[model samples]
Structure formats: C-alpha cells, structure tokens
Target: MDLSNIPKPIWYALTAFLLLTIGYGAANHVPGLNSSDKESAENKASTVPNSSSVKVSVFDEATQAPVVGAKVIVESQGGSDTDTTDNLGAFRVQIPTTDYVKVRISKNYCEPYNQDLNLKSNPDRPKPIFLKCSVPQKKYMPSS
Candidate 1:
C-alpha cells in the first residue's frame, strides 16, 4: 500500500475517527463501562425501594447444626449481593421484587448449594438450605 498521496491531516483525522468509533462501540456494548458511578448508583437506588428482603439460613445436613462463616451470594439482573453468615448461620439480602435470582452458598468444610428463586411468582419466604459434606480422613504411614 502506498500512503505518500494521503496528506498528514487526512491521516490524523482518519485515526481520530477510528479511535472515537471504537470507544463509542465499546462503551455501549461492554457492561459496566457505559455508565458513570453516580449514574449506576442512582439506578440501583431507584430499584431498591421495591426490593424484598430475603433471609437465608445455612445448616449442616448431617448434624443439623448451624453452619457459621458461610458465604452467600444472591444474583439477579439488577446486580448481586454477598454476605457471610454470622454465628447464627443466617444472612439477609435485598433483591428486586420482580426478577429471578440465583442464590449460592458455600463453605470450605461443607458442600456448596445453589438454587433458583422466582421472586415475582412465589412472593413467599424462601426455604433454608442444608449442606452435606463428607468427613475428612487422615492418612497414616509407617515410620522408616
């Protein structure tokens, strides 16, 4: 390709236009990149007033004891909220009233739990989750 015929100003203008086009495309298509922090916060605030508070309690399936320090993540189209269970093995989160949410619970010592919740159709309190995990075993070796 020969570029000697093209003027420097035209080349600079073409480069600027290409950059602007790419930036606009990325800002529109990429998630979380299009909106400013304040705008995103405002959007969340507008939806939160109509949200419902969902409480989740975790327990061990074997012993039925409360599972403490478990991590709970609730996700929906709006966003996601994460919390850790306290000594009572319970955590609460606010989710939009009309969206379906995916709830995930995890603990190092117990099996992970996942459930899909329909907040609009159900409109009822969620059920508690119980995790079942196998007991860890130790290995023994003969001394040399």
Candidate 2:
C-alpha cells in the first residue's frame, strides 16, 4: 500500500461541508440564485404614513428671534399637543398620521396664531412664519 493514499470518506466529508457552506451563503446573498423572500403588504401598510411628529416655534414678527418658553398647542384630527420648547424655543410633538389638522401658538406677551397642517407639511426643517402680537386699541380708535 502507498502511504500517500488517504481515507476516501474523510475527503468526501470535507468537500461536502465546504460545498454546503458556500451554497448557504450564496442562497442568501445571490438574488437570482435563490427564491425571493419578500415582505408582505401588511408589513408595509402598517408602517405607511408613519408621520406623527410636529415642530413648533415662537418668534417675534419684528425681531425674528425664537421665543423661549412659548406655549404651543397643536390641534389635529386626533387632538395632540407638542412637548414644551427647550431653551432654544423649539417644541416637538408627536401625533397620529391622520391627525394632521391645525396648530395654535399662544403666549402672554404675543398674539395667538392658528395654522392648518398635514403630514405633507414641513415644519421641522427650519421654516419661518411671521406672527404679530395683538395690539391694544387707543381711546382715539373706537371699537366696532
């Protein structure tokens, strides 16, 4: 017998293991090599319109600066309120997607303003809207 000759079963087992590992990897990686395993509609629909966030800010119409500690109320179809603003005067609110309706801002020193909003609205991304404080009428101007 030749010493160079080795057991056939051991070589076969090694080859099989290597081939199995390669096949498994290719099946998962290769698109055309394996059957497609895709997500169902329920998974996507359940996550659609996932918007539930709103941003509110208060600024002086003349100064154009953020109003810190300003009171902000966001009334949507689902009725939601935004979290209090930070030192920078930025408030973020989370509401239902279908609830995108209107937003109201109030402050003792300034007038209140209401705006209609929807999920399509882009408020979070640095938008500036002018709001003027209510001016008191002098005795010279008579009320209606």
Candidate 3:
C-alpha cells in the first residue's frame, strides 16, 4: 500500500466511509449505546408482570346496598391505587403481584373500613367491602 501516490481527496472519502461504518456498528451493537426502540419496549414490559384486574365493590353494611361515591384505596409495594365507586358501586383496578396490600374504604356517614388482603392466590375475584353507616337522630319540637 503506497500512500504517497494516492490522491488526497480519495483518501479523505475512504476515511470518512470507514469511520461512519464503525460508528453505526457501535451504536447498534454496543450494550449501553444500543438502546433502540425495541429495547425500551422490552424494558417497559419487564418492569411489571403478574398484574391482575382486582374487582372492588363497596356497599353499605347496614342496608346491604351498594354505596356509590365511596373511596377505595389500595396500597401496595409498587404504589397506591385509588378510585371512587361508580353508579354500580364497583370499580376495577390493576394490582401488581405482591404478598399483601392494605385496602381502605370510606364514604359519607359511614365508618371507614381498613383491611389487609392477600390477592396472590385469587387475584381476579371480586372483593366486597362493607362500610358501617349511621344516621343522625332527628330533633322534635313541641309548640304550646
């Protein structure tokens, strides 16, 4: 290979092509440098697994009726999930797989209920929460 005889422009073009090939290869093949769209998608999927749709239903304990507008809070290792009861007094939430979680239910004029539930065994089952409700005594007036 005699470099003294070769033209300068031709050498520069060849050098540029070689550098580009190496840079592209490194960007696609290197571990940390090769963060493509596919790798990011896989990372997102691997972050959470074994998630289940846990159905939660809130009801009035005294009347045994559905309690609308009730707040349902589920605390787990991943994070806390909260939702208000709909017209059917039910809502579905995604709970990541864990040993146990704290479930809290609260509504107006009702005693808040708190409990720890283990949903690992059966995660798809509907959990019914009963909130004790109370009514204030009515006052009477006598006129002479």
Candidate 4:
C-alpha cells in the first residue's frame, strides 16, 4: 500500500486507534492496570461451584465474648472468598468447590487464626472455628 496518498487526518486517526489497541492489551495483562470490576467478575465466574457454606465464629479467649467485625477468608487451590463477622461474631461464607481449604480469621486487638479444613467428609455441618486474642503487655517505665 502507498502511504504518501493517505490524508493527514486519516493517518492521525489510524495512529490513535493503533495506540489505543496496544494500550488496552497492555492494561489487561499488566498487574494493577486492569479495572477491578472486570477482574472480580472473572474470578467469580471461574470460582463458581455447586455451592457449600462454612460458618466461622470469633471470640475473645479470656472474656469468652464474641468478637464482632472480624474478617474471615477461605482459600483453596481453585479460589478464595472473604466475609466479615456479624454482631454475633459469626460469618458464613460460600465455598466454591468441595475441596480442602485454608480458613483464616483476623480482627483488631485479637490474634489471627488459620486452619486447613477438609470439606469432602462434612459438607453440610462444619464445626465452628474459634479464635483467641492475646492480651496486650503493659509497658514498664523507669521512675523519674
């Protein structure tokens, strides 16, 4: 094709289109460049399963009181899901598939908890997972 005959506007438009195509391709492949909404949608689609639920509860070890607003995460070879504890300190999350997964729970002013669970045997009823918080140590100051 002869490029000398092409108009300036047409060349500019073609250049802009080519640049846009390249940018879009790079954004999709580069980490953190792609929009989160699209990434989350893909993750959800790939991790979908027949559906199973797991309940987790967070509590203070010394006071034996429920810990509210705790974050819970369930991860497996396939994918992972996250949830937060309610006022009752309980969080229920849906599992993508019936497989072994690692459950992690964390809350402010409390110790984090992690455990590997096997969902193959008990799919319906899973034992409640508990987390213990460590007492903050008091700092001693020298007498002035």
Candidate 5:
C-alpha cells in the first residue's frame, strides 16, 4: 500500500469515485427513495394516452367497508404504475389506453386481489374492487 508516488489528480479522482459510490449506495437504501424514483422514471418514459385513467377502490369483503392505504399496481404492455389508496380506499392511476391491463390490489391482513381487466370494454370510470381478509384457520386437535 505504498502511495507516496501517486499523483494528486489520480488521488482526487479516486476520492471522487469513492464518494459517488457511497452516495449512490446510501440513496438506494433510503426508504421510499428508490421506488419513487423508479415510478417517476416509468411515468416519464410512458408514451400512453394521458386521458385514460383507472380508478381502483379496495373494500373489505366481510364488512363491505372501505380499506384504506391499500397498495394498487396496474401493469400493461407499456409499463407499470403504483399507487396507494386514499382515505376513501380509492386510487386513481393514469394508465395507457390499452386493450388489457393487469390490476393487483393488496393490503396488510387482507388477501391480495388480482384481475386482468379489459379496459376497452370497461367504462371510463373508477371500478370498485373487494378484498377478503386472509384469516388463518386453526387446526383441530384430536383428544388424546
């Protein structure tokens, strides 16, 4: 590790590279930073019609109550979009006007709901989707 003869410019370049590497690694690990960046990039890269929108609402199957803070993902041939439901348990995501798109809705303690929708046939309005709670059943023990 004899660096006494190393040039100042080379040392500076190496230091800069190391700093950049550390900064990038730190940024990637920050909560919500990576996903937000990717989502923004995907949105900018999308070439779909801006007029088309998909409205997804999550509801509890048993109680028929709105499930807030649900994660909604819509995927099409163009790209994928992610959103979270509001207090009304609704997420309106702008999507490309395509023939078909896959929609997935998930929430903690609830079973994920997935469906392939025909956007062309469906009306240009928000659709309500229901999700059932995934309550684990207990096993019955036999008497000894």
Candidate 6:
C-alpha cells in the first residue's frame, strides 16, 4: 500500500528488508565484489611458477658465517643441472613448482657437506635461504 497509509514501524521494516535484498543481489553478481572472484583469486595465489629461480645461500656450520668461494651444486629430482653458486656461496637456481633439490657445499677448510632442499612451495623472488656446511678449523702445531 501507500506509505502514508501503512503503519510507521511496518514501513521502516519493509524499507530495511528491501535495502538488504538489493545489497545481497549486487554483491552476488558483481565481479570484483563477488565471493566467487575472491575464491578464484585465492586459488591463483596458491599457484607457483615451476620455472622460477630462487636464490639460496650457504653458511659455515660452526660460525654461521657466509662462506665465500664455497662450491655449491644444485641438482633437481630429474637429475638435471639447475644452476651453480657464486663466489659468495650463493646460487641462483631455476627449480620446479615441486622438486627435491640437492645442495652440496664444500670448501678447502671444511669437510664435504651435502644437503637436501625440498622446494615444494614456490618461494617469492629474491628470498635468501641459509644452508649449513661442515666447517673445520686448521690445526696449528707449535714450531717443533
């Protein structure tokens, strides 16, 4: 009926109900505002680039210091060479979205080191990952 003929409380309730219904319809149909879009965005965000390269660093096991010139080899699960480490004991290696990576760090002063890096989740770019190595100190014999 007409607003002037309806009771005031009923009029307010009807108005509130209509406003809520419009909002619900718009929220369901709008692309950027719909729940489906939010769900899709979350799914996309979970996806990782398999071909991306991640940077990892090697440090001395004893002192936790960066071991420059340390030899590091990165091999994938498929027995393919990804990349090699730099002089700073850092390596930029291209890995898969999910991979079993092998990291070998060695230096003249340290014992042979081997590590297995499981890269199932694609870590964001330029992330620094620290690895452990077997570092040995040189023995000093007094001038005998």
Q: All candidates' lDDT scores? A: 0.75, 0.62, 0.76, 0.73, 0.77, 0.59
Where does the lowest 10-residue lDDT sum fall in candidate 1? 38-47
In model 4, which regions exceed 4 Å deviation?
1-47, 134-144
lDDT tens digits, residues 1-144, model 1?
Answer: 998899999999999999999999888644477765554532352347667777777888998888899889888776677878979888777666656779899988687889886666545565577899556776888899
Between 3 and 4, whose lDDT is larger?
Answer: 3
Estimate the TM-score for candidate 2: 0.49
What does candidate 5 score in Cα RMSD to the true structure?
A: 12.1
lDDT (Cα, tens digit) per residue for candidate 4, span 95-139: 566678898888876778888987777666645666777767889
State the lDDT of candidate 2 residue by residue for 1-144, as single tens digits: 673466788778888999999989877644345665574331232233554556656667877777767676666565455444557667666555763557777766677778876556564563444567554565777779
Cα lDDT tens digits for candidate 6, 1-144: 455998889989999999999999888644457646344432231233545455677666667677677666666653333334566667565544445667666667667767666665556543344545554566988996
lDDT score for candidate 5 against the true structure: 0.77
Candidate 1: segments with Cα more than 4 A from true spot: 1-47, 118-126, 138-144
Tens digit per residue, CA lDDT, model 5, 11-89: 9999999999998887764445565544445354243555477777788888888898988899888777887898988
* Model 5 residue pairs with clashes: none
lDDT of 1: 0.75
Residue 97 lDDT (model 5): 68
Shift in Å, residue 9, candidate 1? 78
